[model samples]
Target: MRTLILALSALALAGSAAFADPIADRQAIMKANGKAVGAIAPMVKGEKPFDAAVVLDALKTLSEDAQKIDVAALFPEGTDKGDTEASPKIWEDMAGFQAKVEKFRADTAAAVAAAPADLDALKVEFGKVAANCGGCHETFRIKKS
Candidate 1:
């Protein structure tokens, strides 16, 4: 009974960590991404310090990195701690998720291709593309404080 109890405790701890992995990754990505994006606003007004092509290049890199995430890997077996902001319905409604993912992929790619030679051109496209992130977060992600 003591051995069985020990095993059960170990299992619970391991299980919780698996569930928390995505939350940890999400936090880390947001930290990096927030800082990266913050650099754009100021550059959007200046000429010497600003380079829309470079910004678009960075966006391409970010989009590539985003694709590396295997979202299903975040889900654990036999879990009950339901704190994940990602809707369980995401798995059930794969078509919608896939469409959103593809849209993000295309939008990011197009924005990069369409990088404006001047700040005026870049700012318009930049804000439009950036809005996609919030839409996904609102629908699929849990609010983080």
Candidate 2:
């Protein structure tokens, strides 16, 4: 019984540790979002042939990634000091930052719903999602040299 208790306690701590660093958590989610964009960017640019299934899958990934972000929890106070590219403007203008996040979520969700099958349709939907990422990065991310 004691051994089982210890094992369970260790599992709980390990699970909690995964969420201990909000910066890392948010960064991981953003990286996943980037990868989703990368997967579809070539088709959008006409460099690769449009595959409807791949486009739809990528959009779904973006939508799921956006849903994982919890702005208030991830951008909490004191997190701005870490090894993060998050700009101070995030904490200062949290409302604007949150608005951008919301826009991203909404845009990605719409893109997934539209499931653009043709290259032209993919271009339009992908453009909206990319714009949200760019706009938020411009205002809320600190560019690293």
Candidate 3:
């Protein structure tokens, strides 16, 4: 009974530890966002045939991933020092950081609503949505060596 109790306690601790790492969780969310962008970028660039369904799917993925970013919870203080590329400016000006996140969400939502079915429309909407990525990264991401 003692051994069983100790094993169960260890399992609980391990589970909590996995969920407690906000840095890892945020990184995963960002990676997913990047992948969604990749999926539609070629279509916008004319490298791949424009597929309305693919564009909508990618836009939805971006919208969902953007919504997952609970800024305060994911970027809580003390998470700054790790394998993270988040800028210190994020903590110093959380409001700005959150605004950028909101902009990204709004842009993604707009892209979805536009439902770009042609290369021309995809270019326009995708440009708006992708700009949020560059703008946010400029202000809220550290340049890695």
- Highest TM-score: give the candidate number: 2
What TM-score number comes out for model 1?
0.61
Indicate whether candidate 1 or candidate 3 has the larger lDDT: 3
Backbone clashes under 3 angstroms, per model? 1, 0, 0
What are the lDDT figures for the candidates, one per model? 0.64, 0.92, 0.91
Q: Which residue segments of model 2 deviate by more than 4 Å?
A: 1-19
- What is the TM-score of candidate 2? 0.88
Name the lDDT of candidate 1.
Answer: 0.64
CA shift of 82, model 1, Å = 7.0
lDDT (10s digit) by residue, model 3, range 1-145: 9999999999999998768889989999999998989999887676899888888999999999989999988999989898999999999999999999999889888889998878899899999988999998998899899
> Over the stretch 75-117, how does candidate 1's per-residue lDDT look in tens digits?
3332214554566556666667666667767776776677667
**Where does candidate 1 have its weakest 10-residue lDDT segment?**
74-83
Question: Per-residue CA lDDT of candidate 2, range 28-102, in tens?
Answer: 998998889999999988889999998999899999989988988799999999699999999999999989989
Look at candidate 3 and tell me the lDDT of residue 5. 100
TM-score of predicted structure 3: 0.86
Residue 31 shift from truth in candidate 3, angstroms: 0.5
Residue pairs in steric clash, candidate 1? Answer: 85-142
